[model samples]
Target chain A: MNSRREFLKLAMAGSTAAVAAPAAASAQAKPKRWGMLVDLRKCIGCQACTVACTIENDVPEGQHRTAVPVYELDGPNGPSQAVLPRLCNHCDEPPCIPVCPVNATFKTEEGAVVVDAEQCVACGYCVQACPYEARFINHKTGVADKCTFCVHRTSVGLLPACVETCVGNARVFGDLNDPESEIRKLMAQHETKGLRPEFKTGPNVYYIGLDDRLASTVAVGGGARDLRQGLETSAHGEV
Target chain B: MPAVDLMSFDHEAVWRPWAVAYFLLVGTGAGAALLLAYARLVRIAEAKGALIVAASFALASGLPLLADLHQPARFMHFYLGSAPGSIMWWGSWFLPLFIVSTLLLAFMTGRRGNAPMCGGERMLTMIVGALALCILGYTAGEMSVVAARPVWNTLGFPVVLILTALMSGAGATMIIDSLNGEKGEGRYMLVVTGAATLVAFGLWMLTDTNLSTLAADYAPVGLFGGFIIAGVVVPVVLAVSAKASLLLRGVSGALAVFGALAFRWSTFNGAQLMSKTETAFYGHEAALSQDALRTLAGSAGLLILSLIFVTLLINLLAVRASKQTQA
Candidate 1:
């Protein structure tokens, strides 16, 4: 039993090491981590970012290009809450990338999960593999899609749509590698959290002001109500 | 329903529909395959007819999955690899196997004096039967892996899917055989009904004990009301009362088809309803989010065109082949 336990631990550690080794080696070579930080305290859930994302990417109607999870928390006095905007956590160990049957979806050098629309066959395999429900098949393009952190914009040194149009200046986009970058600085100063850290997807998107209950709920079952809705609608009507 | 902000991410809602479609397609295909295998095993005269139906259903079920894809053309990539770790990945590998097995079974039985090589055929049927069970088991495992959907994350799902596949497939075969003027598929019917009852019972037990089991439970209502009563129960009762009545057999068979289809549809819909209701408090829209709707429309259009083309091609080929055979 002791030997078996030891073997299991070694196997687990070996696999973990194998997955992390690539990211760690890549991080060392680049010495820069690409990430997004959202300040929940400042966000008003105006949804400008969502709109901008759809417009910029020409995302189809009915499928979300990005999703901002809104939480109505019980405040100190009355029922007050905050909206926690989420997209592809763009995990350091992205569950969606390697599971792609055709390598249509992949991670870029800058650590963003990118989908080549042309290469995508619209199989929902990656969508299912994703723990965050971040990936969706874009109807028009016939490709799996999620927040790329606006790879197209970022290439030209522009901020992501969510970050660019934040009325409350809640969302921040920057290289996590640079110590002086806004996102890096925020991480250093604040006690921010990622959604479902226990799953260890190593999400790059970090959040501030996420309640413990909400986080735990997401972590344990990955948005159960949302899963239920998708299943119900697809049965009676067209998916 | 109020239009919740489309941008809000509710994980359950987003994943639910895709899962339902996946489950339905997998269930339908496996069920059809198993029925075909059972028909072959029992040496049913119209076993070839059942095989054709199974293959056609399996092929048809691939349609919804295309719509589910973000890039429908890229679906071939799944076939390019041999990834054993993923149920979806491995499930895909079974498609061609099923196709080949069905084609072989059809070819062997379609002609009057040419049955599948006796011993070889039996072995093939057994192999395909085992594979069909594997596919069904994988379908259940696929859902169970979600972990987040407490109802889906269990062992009962795999068993239910396997048994449901057998019941549905056997039920379909009995009906088709009766339609083709073959009688006395009673033993197969009994086996199917027995299997279905056990599966239904297991499903009920799971739902009764677990609050999280709502996702699967909602399906049986449709199954019993739409399929079981209309398709299996009434006909089965009639057939039981009167032996060797082609009329009774035909009715039961028809009911079985209806029940199987209804079961697939309900199971797909019920899971989605559970996910939607459970997550409504999160403020995400229950309707198709913008991106998903557009994808669906695009996939639908493509699938419609493809089906038209495929049907025309198949019809033309069939005409030519029949003429050659006659000559």
Candidate 2:
């Protein structure tokens, strides 16, 4: 009984310290910067990541959780193509978060923008607010749903469904805060670009070998289009 | 005409007509309800007429929305969950509340005996007022969410919707009050009508100056041209002036209704034109590319003609109904 009391006392002290230490340390710790890097040069458009993502998440048909927009570029000699795997950019300054009247959607400390499915009323407002078409109404739940970046898998130290199944090993994921991480190393080595950077969404996903010329082809306020020369150059260079 | 691309024929792509119809109907309903609620609060004699108009508007708004639904049978799904995050969800809940409260207020007032309003009755009326404001605000927010379309993506949208509803409601009350031979209702009508017009004009001018292209798409020829002058400025001027007779009041009320409908229609048309133009002119062409201009002209023509026809029909019916009620 004495030993039990001592154990209980130690456990209480441990719990109090655990709560207090984080509160103190959080003030000192720099905000964690999270990001993703895609090596487009290595991406073969095999679509292994796309299928894997759907199966793992049970994404609905006709509405994709993630989409690979295939841009066909006409060239001097022949037709070439470049594929951009479009998903939630998980923007640093998320537009969708502020518009939710009920605070059903919000950003996490890890910088992932998540929606509370229970709180969502399935108004389709967030779907329209997303400039990149990242969100879609889950037909089953009748609520706004999108890529969670495999939060469940990532928490368990497992790769995202997409990253795990990427055939070309094009997608690299890691804690961007860790200097030793592969993502950090690759980002350090390469100049990266993001879609609609002018919107200043501060997207975490970065692309290497992003055809700047092709990106420029997207007219201001106009939606997507195909660029012939840029795609040919990118495809030829990659092969 | 450009060869019609049948493969990409999106039923969802044709959003303007539906959006305009929805906005106009909802605006009218919200406006009529506010007028009735205010009349009841103030213990006005024309409260019964206003209540009837409010109920009519609410019922009219529901028709278009029901028609717009792909699966009308599943309409009850909106009420199944208290989805506060969605404007439509909140609107669905609030609209019914407003309708029920308005019915109860109408019932209480209809009783011939001199019975004082119960505490529950007063509380319910207050709740209806608050709910009506919410519905107005939510409708505006719903429109503003279409960020890709610059015309609909303004901070002014929700505020404009509220003001428009108030103006529409006030205009509706004036017409009903005049026909019913209520004394001094015309002055109240004139004041609200003038204020509503000024607010509508001020908001349009502010929006025009800030977003020039959006203004061009909406008011095209100038402020004096298109629906603004015909629907808002003219009606307001007529309603305010001393020469404004009962005939003039009827004309002004008709104009106000027309203006509200036209404004909504123009907004819907402008958004569609802007998107189509942007899609056609992308990177390779000038901002005002020939193809973009053509699309704009075609869309504007279609929208304006449709408005004229619909307005004429609604006004003819309304005038006839007012005459019969008076007789």
Candidate 3:
């Protein structure tokens, strides 16, 4: 009888804790939905953001957490260099999430996609499933790594390393949920675009002055791709 | 084109040769298990080779799969967390159960006397057969759902994968029978499945919108030269023409399995070599690392060791039965 009474009291306490948890959560300000906006017009192609990201994330050599791909378009006024700074889109319908066999990768409450190194089995299934080619197996960590939107700094009321170091003020990082945030205001003022709209990934990262011609079809041959291929081929004794 | 890339790095391949080995071994084992089920139902003593191949290959398939992962030791994460949504996670559960069922069936087959199989043994074969199909389905399904890869996501891809597995499985059965100094009926099985595999490939190349667009340029030499000519055409021709020679039959068996491996290499590696963002192919060459070589050797060694175990077990059962008869 005494045991049963104690059990009932414990069950009541547990239910009360569950009920109180959400109430406590609601009392605090709602979590921020972080997103990035890149204004191509402002970008001077200095690659300062890329350098800062590499140093900040400790990404190994010959790999990138973020990089700008420059394309030379054959315009009516002759050829011109165009820059498109690329990183993880942190898609609302992220393909990388469900494909993780261990549930090691997930969208944070603040809307950043992140990988838990400890839980990752490094099967590379998620890497294969990612449409953006954003994720990779980090050689040093031996786990899937991608741009986490620099969550460690963002959570502590600081800007991401890339955004902080951006020379042209091109990369904008802010809370999408907050109405008065700079990203939201910028998004409202301009006709924004996202890469690979055909994929319907619903990318949170918006861009201003994104060239429509550079959407999908890029001409074959020549680039860092060829240079990297030569290095890789030589390394593997294919040369 | 309106634009030329001044600078961009091509995406690198994540799945390697070890993944291909795992798929090949498991598919062969699953196919052999299906054949073993048919043989058990009909009491075809000639298909004893199928039973051995099914158990041994299934047992040997897991190592390469684990080795494919960067964190081979961390596979327990698959079961430690619940992930019903992931096909690979579902495979983690299905694979071990399939292996156990195949092994259990082999054990039961050994213990059963020369008298026809009882109801219990017949039921066991059905269970093993069901699990074998699940393994095949899960493996193919896991690859199919990745819509990111245009070549892999096609409806025809799974059909080709399944047909080739069946073809390889039939070939392995013929190999075991030929080695056992017998003319088995697996030649006809090989012919039909091998032909079906070619038909599936042709259909895939012709029908799949993405593959049809890319097939002319993207299909590497391995598919046409290695898989179709050497793997299917040569072995299939031998299987059809040389009906009496057991040595020729064994040769066909080896070639069929090799063809299946070639198909996987051609498709898995070939599709990955294509740049998702561009029209060009990535420069990828298989570098046989020490780790990959060790895994390959380990799988072969494990198969031979498993074969010895099964041989001794059946022989022991036969000896015990003879002693009981004398008593």
Interface RMSD of each: 7.9, 12.9, 3.8
Question: Of 1 and 2, which scores higher on TM-score?
Answer: 1
lDDT of 3 at B224: 76
Q: Give Cα distance to truth, residue B107, candidate 2, Å.
A: 1.1
By TM-score: ranked, best first: 3, 1, 2
The true-versus-predicted C-alpha distance at residue A117 of model 3, in Å, is 1.0
Considering TM-score, which of the candidate structures 2 and 3 is the better prediction for this target? 3
Please provide, for model 1 over A29-106, each residue's C-alpha lDDT reduced to its tens digit, 9 standing for 90 to 100.
Answer: 645557888888888887788888888888877566675655444556855645767678888988776555566777
For each candidate, give the TM-score of chain B: 0.68, 0.71, 0.92
Which candidate number would show the highest lDDT if scored against the true structure? 3
Any runs in candidate 3 off by more than 4 Å, and if so which? A1-30, A227-239, B42-46, B209-219, B287-295
Q: How many residue pairs in model 3 have overlapping backbones?
A: 0
lDDT of model number 3: 0.79
**Best DockQ goes to which candidate?**
3
Overall lDDT per candidate, in order of appearance: 0.58, 0.58, 0.79
Quality of candidate 1's docking, in CAPRI categories? incorrect
Tens digits of lDDT, candidate 3, B40-95: 67655536788777887888889889988999999999999899899999899989
**Considering only chain B, what TM-score does candidate 2 achieve?**
0.71
Residue-by-residue lDDT tens digits, candidate 2, B1-327: 121111111111233244456566567657766665676677544454455555555545654555444334556666664556556667777767765666555554444223455677666666666767777877887767666555566766555556666666666656665675543243365356546556755675665543454454333432334446776677778777735477677677667766676566555544443322112211122224464355435434543453344334344555665566666
